[model samples]
Target: MTASPPDNSAQMASPSYRLAVFDQDFLLSDSLRGVRFLLEFAKADLALKAWGVRSTVVVFGSARVRENGDPDHARWYAAAREFAALASQRGGAFLEGGPVRDNVIATGGGPGIMEAANRGAADVGAPSVGFNITLPHEQEPNAYSTPELTFRFHYFAMRKMHLAMRANALVVFPGGFGTLDELFEILTLRQTSKSPEIPVVLFDEGYWRGIINFDEMARRGMIAQKDLDLFGFAETADGVWQELVRRGLKPHEDLESLTKSP
Candidate 1:
C-alpha cells in the first residue's frame, strides 16, 4: 500500500503551537498575572530612568474639580496649577540636559486637579509626569503633561508603586474617595516605615478637616499623636511649598549645593 502524505495542518493550527510572547490570550490569563505586573512596573520605570527623573513631587486631588466650577473647585484647581508650576521651576525639573532630575511634578494624569498641576508644569516649560490608569469610566490623560512621560497602567497597585517610589514629597489638593485612598496609602507607608520619609502636605486645611476627623482619630486612640503630624495643611500654592519645606522637602538648589560640597 502506498504511504499517504503526512498530515501537519492540525498541529500547526493548535493554540499550543503559538509563541508565548505573541499569544495575547495566554499572556492575559490569570497564570501570567505576575508577568503583567512586572511589565507594568518596568515600562514606567525605564521611561522615568531614561528621562533622568531621580525624584518627583507627587500631586494628588479630586478629578472632579473644574477651573470654572463652584468657588471651592475653582480655587482648588487654581492652587494646584500654581503649585505645580512653582515646584517644577524650583525643583530642578527645568534643568536642561541634566543627568539627574529632582522633584519633577507628577500627577494622577486625569482632569481637575491633575490637569491643573500638569498645566502648571507646562506653563513653566518643564517636563511633568502623568501616571494615568485604566478605569471603567475611562480616565483620559490631560494635554498638559509631557507626552514622553505620560504613562497608562492597567493595575492600580503598579500605578501606585510608580507614584510612591520616586516621590520626594506629596502635595494633596481637595478630593474625594480616590484622593483619600492615595493620601492614606502614603501615610500608611510612612507610618510603617515601608518607604523613605517624605514631606506630605494637604491643600485647604478646612476641606480636609471637614472630610476626615484625623484629630478625633488620634484622640480616640485609632492613631498615635505623632501620626497626626505626618501631614500638615496649606491654603495656597505658596503655602503648600512652604509647608513642604518646613516639613523637610528640600529644594533642588540645596540638593545641588550639597552634592558639590567637600
Candidate 2:
C-alpha cells in the first residue's frame, strides 16, 4: 500500500477513524487523518509549488552501477561526474539561457549512480536532494542532501509522485529493472498525457544501446518512430546542454490546474 494514501481525504471529520501511515517519526511529525494532515501535505505541494522549488533535474540510475578502474567503467563514472557538475553549475551549460543557476540535483537517495550524482553535486559545494525509498533493502539516505530537501517514502508510487511533483526534466543514467520500470512509468504517463509534459534525457548511449533493443521493437511495429521521440540521449554534459536548450527549458513545475474551491 502506498504510504498515506488520501483514503481519509473525505472522512477527515471523524477523529476516531484516524489511521497512522508512518512510523512514529513520520506519523508524529507529519500527522495523519483529518483535514489538518491533508492540508499540511497539500501545502507542502503548493509551497515548493514548482515555481518556488529549486530548479531541479531528476537523476536516475542503478544502485548497482559501479565505477571500477577499468577503462570503460572509469570513463563512464568520470563522464557521469562531469555531467552532474555541469548541471549543478550556477548559470552553467544546463542553465545557460535560464534564470536558474544552482540547479539542485535530485536522486533516489541510495547508492550507485544516485549517490554518484549527489556526490558530484556536493563536490561543487552544493548539496543535492534525495527522495529516498523505504524498501526492504532500506535504501539509505545519502549524505549529500540539503537538510530541508531530504525525504523518505514508504511507498514507491508516493516517492515517484514526489519525484515528478517538482522535476523539470529527467536524466536517466545506466540502471537495471528498477530504472527501466521508472523510465517506462514516466513515459507511459507522458504518452497518455496523464502527467505534465517534461523532457527525459537518457544518459550513457553505450549502456542504453547495450541494454534495451528499442530498434527491434520499432521494426516489429511494436512501437512507433514518433513514440521514440519521447526521449533523447546525452553522453556528455555538453550534449545534455544542447538538448536542454533545444527543448526550451520549462520551469521545474507543479500542479496549478486543480480547480480551487470557491
Candidate 3:
C-alpha cells in the first residue's frame, strides 16, 4: 500500500483541468453566452475584413418562395436572382484588386430568395456573402454563396449586426414574418439614425402594400409622413438598382472618381 502511488487520474480528468478555450462544455455553458456572442461577432468580422468587404447590399426575402413554385413565387425568385446579378456586376463586388469591395450582395443564406440572390452573384462570377442562422429547424446555407464568404451564426442579434454594419443599401423582396422582421429592423435603425443612411428598396410594391398599409400607418400618425420616405418601391431587378442609385447609393466607379477628384 505504501508503494502504491496516489491515483491522480480523476483529478487530471476533471473539467477544471481542461484548458478554458478547449473546454467545449464550459464554453457552451449559460455563463459563457456573452463570450459566444463575441466569438460569433469576431469570427465574421475578421473574415469580412480579410475579404475586403467594405460595404454590402443586404437582400431580405421569403425562404418559402421557390423558382419552380407557383406563379408569384417563380416571379419573385427570378427577380431576386436578376437583381443580385445586376448589382454584383455594377456594384463594387466585381472590382478586383481594390483596397475595398463595396455594394457586395448579402443574403440571409437560405433557400428561395436568399438562394436566388446568391445564385445571381454566382452567375456573374462574383463573390457574395451568406449570413446563415441556426434555427430550431436548422436552416441550411444556399449553394451559390461564395464558399469562403458563407457564415453561420447561432445568435440572431449577432447575425443582424453583421448584416447592418457595412450595408450600403437594403433590398427587400416579398416574404412573410421573418422578412418583415428584417425589413423593420433596418428601417428602425435608419429612423433612429443608429446606422448610416443606406438606400432601402422594396421589390413588388403591390405585394408590400397588400401585406401592410404603410399609408394607413402614416395617416394614423403612428409613423410620420416623412418616415414614409425611408424606403421606396421597385417593380423589377433593374428598377431596384435605379431606385438604390436614386436614393444615394454610390457605385464603385463613382466612388473611385470622387476619390481621384480634386
Best candidate according to TM-score: 3
Residue 140 in candidate 3, Cα distance off native in Å: 0.9
lDDT per prediction? 0.93, 0.67, 0.94
Pairs that collide in candidate 1 are: none
lDDT of 3: 0.94
lDDT of 2 by residue, 56-91 (tens): 677888777666756655665666666677677632
TM-score of predicted structure 2: 0.71
Q: Which is the better candidate, 2 or 3, if ranked by TM-score?
A: 3
For residues 71-188, write the lDDT of model 3, one tens digit per residue.
Answer: 9899999999999999999998965777888899999999999999999999999899999999989898999999989999999999999999999999999999999999999999
Cα displacement (angstroms), candidate 3, residue 217, comes to 0.7
TM-score of each: 0.95, 0.71, 0.96
Better of 1 and 3 by lDDT: 3
Regions of model 1 farther than 4 Å from truth:
1-5, 258-262
